[model samples]
Target: MPAQVICIGSVLWDIVGRTPRNMALSNDVPGRILRLPGGVALNIAQALAKYDLSPVALTAIGQDTEGDDLMKASADLGLDMQFVHRPDDLPTDCYMAIEGANGLIAAIADAHSLEAAGDAILAPLTDGRLGSETSPFSGVIALDGNLTLALLQEIAQNPLFSNADLRIAPASPGKAERLRPFLTHSRGTLYVNLEEAGILVDRLFDSSQDAVRALLDAGAARVMVTHGGRDATFGTPDLITSQTPPKVNVTRITGAGDTFMAAHIAAEIQGASPSDALNAALAAAASYVSGDTILS
Candidate 1:
């Protein structure tokens, strides 16, 4: 089947430890450990697949055992992997995070392989397979800030992306500033939390509405700011909308943002209104964090 969306960035394993108790600095607690196929881009792709949208993965994965297993797992989830770069010398990437009843305490991302592979993963875009310079892809593309700043900047200015509906997200708060290049991109829409939005604008925001206005003032063509259990706001220069997520116990927090972005994209593609799309996204994210939806 043809790919309906392009997901670009890290494709890796996630080693997550979850504990029911609230945690603090230097605290150790007994918890369940699980290893799953995850990464910002991969998580979004996996979520898109759940909506029956064929998503093509554009990222680098090593040719080792871990990479092979990851490929099998992604295929099982129905992600198109024909465009994934597999380098023999590099090792598969991984992300580790510790989550408690409170929230995410700490996390580390080892995306060196993806950074080292550089723009090799994007060959399909300019090689006439998906798109070329003369004819650019006009479909939806989801990008993550796990990519190096240089590459992200290039994509922001490249003509190949000028016509695409670009949806981007920061991999984490630490890497949020890497997405500054797209602040003025005409077709780009950013998905970020309150903190991440604040980082991009270099100031603290009190609420999602404030962050939305700040990001738009900072030249974002469109932006969505989520404030955990508070309201989530979506804004463009012409119109701004907000939706409050359903209150639910956050049993997990890792992939909730990705689920929101994917669900929002799918809803918009299905011709939902701005208000309806925001509601759908918030509901999907609430389901994910509440552990009500089964994770693949």
Candidate 2:
């Protein structure tokens, strides 16, 4: 497959309210607040862009001022922003989160706009620009479970993605089950954490290696399971490999997993072996979690 342009699942801005100190309960703390173009899809696509890969975002942002600003941001990042469906009545989607020194305490994703827009965001892919159902875009496609379950199921069944190299991540641990449809996809590669992998396999795994094995047994074509501050596992149809993440002081953790996924894809696309890919991803994620790398 030609691996030029990749499409990330759903794109939107993230409004993050973060504090330096950790708190146990819902005690409001004052700290730096930031709003950026984020989402599992956008973050992964942005990281891919850093590697000089042109990525198109298949997402819905509303036809509003926020959406306009988001489009400008996407363009500035050198992303292909066409096919971002905007409905007149729907407002642009957003994700709001609170992060402390520990990790992300809570998050609310308002992606109703994308859900309403449905497959309209994929119009370009189905048209001549990218690919259609007949001659599908056989490129690297990064998918996320931020999409509705039904849409994911449809994508799993769609011939347009049947031939593409699929690298997928669940938007969150709670959404991991939504990726079940792609478990059997011939070309799907799953990037998941131990918790998410356990969710998919409907069991508990004491180690990343165990999680990787369980995921492979559950029918994933390829699997990578990350354990924070522990060993991360990578697997092909025949072999499974492991790499330990470099130890670092964890400053933040919101986009760390997404960074790892992007780095993994970029490594493989650059012809790295599974061990090399996992190592690259681990280094990238370690730097990101240590707040050494910018923009995930």
Candidate 3:
């Protein structure tokens, strides 16, 4: 099947340790540790694949055992891996996180391989394989801030992406500022949490609504702000809509935001109304956090 969208950025393994009880510094409790295929782009692509969107991965992976496993896993999940760049010298990247009852305690992302690969990872887009400047890709492009700031800025101004529907995510709160270039790009739509919005706008927002308004005022053409279990809002200069996620016991936290973003994109692509898309995204995220299987 042809690719419906392109997911760009980190593609790696996630090693997560989760404890049902609250934890603090230097405390080690009995918990389950699992390794899963993850990363912002992969997470979003996996979610889209669940909806039969057939997203193509445009990122870097090492030519190692882990990278081979990730490719097989992505293919098994129905993602297109033809565009993934695998360099023999680089080791596969990974993210390690410790999540406790209170929430995420600490995390480390070893995405040096991706950073080193740089624009080489985007060769498919530039070398007339997937797209070119003269005939820019017109499909949706989901981008993550795991990319270096230089690459992100280049994409923001590059002609190759000028005609694409750009959906941007910061990957995490720490990387939110990397999305600054897209704030003024007309084709870009930002997906961020309240904290990320605050980072982008340089101010604290009391709610998602305020964050949406602030982002719009700050030159974001389109924006979506999610506030964990609180209300999430999608907005533009002319219109804004909000929805509260269904209440549920939180069982997992990783990949929830990516799930929401993917669901919203899939909903919009399927011709859902603004309200319907927002509601669907919230419900999907709630289901994911509540430990419901997202894909059949």
The TM-scores of all predictions, comma-separated, are: 0.97, 0.95, 0.97
lDDT of 3 by residue, 46-134 (tens): 99988888899988898889999999987888788998999999999999999988888999888899999999988888778888867
Better candidate number, 1 or 3, judged by TM-score: 1
> Which candidate has the highest TM-score of all?
1
Q: How do the candidates rank by lDDT, highest first?
A: 1, 3, 2
Report how far residue 131 has shifted in candidate 3, in Å.
0.9
Candidate 1 per-residue lDDT over residues 1-296, each given as its tens digit = 54499999988999999999999999989999999999999999999988888999999999999999999998888789988999999999999999999999999999999999988989999999999999999999999999999999999999988889999999999999999999856549999999999999899988999999998998899999999999999999999999899999889999889999999998998899999999999999989998987355
Clashing pairs in model 1, backbone N/Cα/C closer than 3 A: none
**Model 2 ranges with Cα > 4 A deviation:** 1-3, 185-187, 294-296
lDDT of 3 at 17: 97
lDDT of 1 at 103: 97
Off by over 4 Å in 3: 1-3
Q: Please give the lDDT score for candidate 3.
A: 0.91
**lDDT-best of 1 and 3:** 1
Report every candidate's CA lDDT. Answer: 0.92, 0.83, 0.91
| lDDT (Cα, 0-100) at 220 in candidate 2 | 87
